[model samples]
Structures are given as structure tokens and as C-alpha cells.
Target: MKQICVFILVLALTSCEYFNAKKTTPEAILNEELQTFNWNDVDVYPTFSECDSIETKNGKTTCFTEVLTTHILEKLQKDSIVVTQDVTDTINLKFQVSETGILSLLNIDTDSLIMKEIPNIEALIYSSLDSLPKVFPAIKRGQQVKTEFELPVIIQAN
Candidate 1:
């Protein structure tokens, strides 16, 4: 009877371990967690200095846009770049805001006509962006993350 009881106890212990064992490897679990994370959405959007007073999401977004637009327009006016011929086009500016609130230009998309008319247009845009105050980068899962923005700049010359 003593031997039978010992054997039963051993079996019970082994079974418990088997039941509690992990079915998936650690790497697999990590991959699953990463896959579940949504890349498109962030917990908090990037903010500019003028947008600090805004409380609502929509209000902040509008303020940010307005501040950036005003900065760019002011810079362009200061440069006084002349277009030989009347032209109207939209320039697409792509930039990334780093976790430390630094803005880096990624790319600028403009038609050939605009490029020819304003050879230093790219430099002007970069200077305008750099002149703005630092921005708080977007936050994801309670951590700051790099975020990208694509802004359309319309240029109309008469």
C-alpha cells in the first residue's frame, strides 16, 4: 500500500507539470504580441507649442495645422522667390518626428515645373520646417514613437 501511494503521488505531480506547461515557445509568444499591436493608431498625437493650450483632439489638430501653415507662409514670404511664369501646383512634404521632438525631412514631392521655377524650393521648405518650435512626438503604448506626416503645400503664382 505504501509503494502504491508513492507511485500515485509521483503521477499526480508529473501530470500537474504537464498541464501547466507552455504550449508555445517564447519567440512565438513575442511574435503574436507584436502582431496584435496596431501600427496605424497611436495613444497620443504629436503636438506643437501653439497647440499646448488645446484640450480636444480636433482642436489640437486644427491648431497644429494652422501654426505650421503660418510658419511656412511666413518663411516663403521672407524668401521672395519669384516664378517666371504663372504656375499652380501642390507640393507634398514628408517628414518624421523623432521621439525626442526633432523633425527630419524625409522627402518632398513637386512637379518638374515647380522644381524648375524654384530651384531652391526644397531648401526653403526645409528651413521653414526647421524654424518651427519643437514638437512632442506621438506616443504608443505609453512610450514615445517616431511619427510621419505628409503635408500638402499649395503654391499659386499669378
Candidate 2:
């Protein structure tokens, strides 16, 4: 009877250990959370005030791009920064729009010649962006989110 009781006790303890084993570790939990987060795309694109009336996604995006480009070109034209030589290059501008509709310049990639000709190019771009109306930030999973954009501005000197 003593041996049988001991065997039963061991079996019960082993069963409990198997049932109570840790199924999820901290690392596994973190990985699962990361998988659930969306990092590739947003639910909606950022928009300018003028684009608010637009209903379609493509239309809004087009309007935003057009308005920003127009504003930048107009500002540059007003500044009268003359390009001494005939050159063709593109300025790559990267910026972020915060959830509160504020614009933040991230980086600017342009030709060294352009930079040399227009030493205050960054200032001009920032000023132009400042003049723009507030923008509705991108949306992700029903929440407003900060978004980044890379715009290529083609510069052709005649």
C-alpha cells in the first residue's frame, strides 16, 4: 500500500508539472506583439487643407503633391536664386508630418552645384513649407499617425 501511494503521488506531481509548463516566454510575447503592429503602410495618406474636400485616396494624394510642389517652386522663383550654369538634377527631400499637422524636415539630397549656387536652399524650402496650410496627418488603424515622405524636385537650369 505504501509503494502504491508513493507511485500515485509521483504521477500527480508529474501531471501537474506538465500542465503548468510555461507556454509563452517574454521574447515570444514580444515577437507576437511586433507581428501584430503594422509597419509597412498607413490606413490613410496625409493631406493638405486644399485636399480635404477630395474623397478618393488617389485624388487626395495627387492634390497634396501638386500643392506642395507648386508652393516650393513659387517660393524658389520669388527668391531669385540664379543658377550660373546649365544643369539638370533632382533634389530629394525627406520630411515628416506629425499627427498634429506640423512639418519637420528630415534630409535633403541635391547636387553639390545646386547647393553651392543656392547656399540658402534649405532655408528657402523650410520657409516655403512653413507657409503651407496645416496638413491632416496619416491614419493608421483608426488613429492619426506621423508619416514620412520623400519628394524628388527636378531642377532644370536653362
By TM-score, the best candidate is 1
- Rate residue 30 of model 2 by lDDT: 91
Model 1 misplaced stretches (Cα beyond 4 Å): 1-29
lDDT score for candidate 1 against the true structure: 0.84
- TM-scores across all candidates? 0.77, 0.74
* Candidate 2 backbone collisions, by pair: none
Error of 1 at 47 (Å): 1.0
Pairs of colliding residues, candidate 1:
none
Predicted candidate 2 versus true structure: per-residue lDDT over 1-158, tens digit per residue: 99999999999988986777567899999999989987968877898878888898888878988888888888777877777787678999998999987878899998898888777888888898878877889988898999999888887666
lDDT of every predicted structure (CA atoms): 0.84, 0.84
- Candidate 1 structure, TM-score to reference: 0.77
CA-only RMSD, every prediction: 4.0, 4.7
